[model samples]
Target: MPASQYADMFCVEVWPENAPAWNLFEALQTQWRAGSGGVIGLDYGVLAEELRVREIPPADHEQLRADVRVMEAAALQEIYAETEK
Candidate 1:
């Protein structure tokens, strides 16, 4: 689930500091939820614009982006089924 995967797919982040944590992303077909193990959710495009207008720091915002990218890449690779091996 690299941000690149979700890059073309639709997605949205979740509440900060929650149990499900950064594990939730609303996409076109399904929700690629995050587990306790990885990634942070960051808003995108116009959504990010709103956050910026509200004075949210880009550093804080992109921090989540960087995380989502890492987690998503791992998740995508994880889609490899045992049968495929």
Candidate 2:
């Protein structure tokens, strides 16, 4: 199909300016977490939905959570030290 013809025949639906992508994603993530087992990461879920338009499985769920916890602890410590200064 020619570019111009394709555009005219199938108008690409655009998200209203009011529904910013980030806001939509946050809403969906909230819903998924509330309903699902909270077994998947938000980034992976969003990327799969928007890009692949399919479900995504958690990648190394245990490892990811562990790494996040370590990072979180370090961040908290840094903040605590900074505040004392």
Judging by TM-score against the true structure, name the best candidate: 1
lDDT of each: 0.48, 0.44
Best by lDDT: 1
**What are the per-residue Cα lDDT tens digits for candidate 2 across 1-85?**
7898887985555557423343334344443222243222334454345433422235534443344444445645665577679
Kindly list the per-residue Cα lDDT of model 1 for residues 1-85, writing each as its tens digit: 8988988695655556631214322221133444675432333454444445557566666665555456566656666443268
- Candidate 2 worst ten-residue window by lDDT: 31-40
Q: Candidate 1: worst 10 consecutive residues by lDDT?
A: 19-28
TM-score quality measure for candidate 1 = 0.36
Model 2: runs farther than 4 Å from truth?
A: 1-56
Give stretches of model 1 more than 4 Å off.
1-56
TM-scores of the models, in the given order? 0.36, 0.34
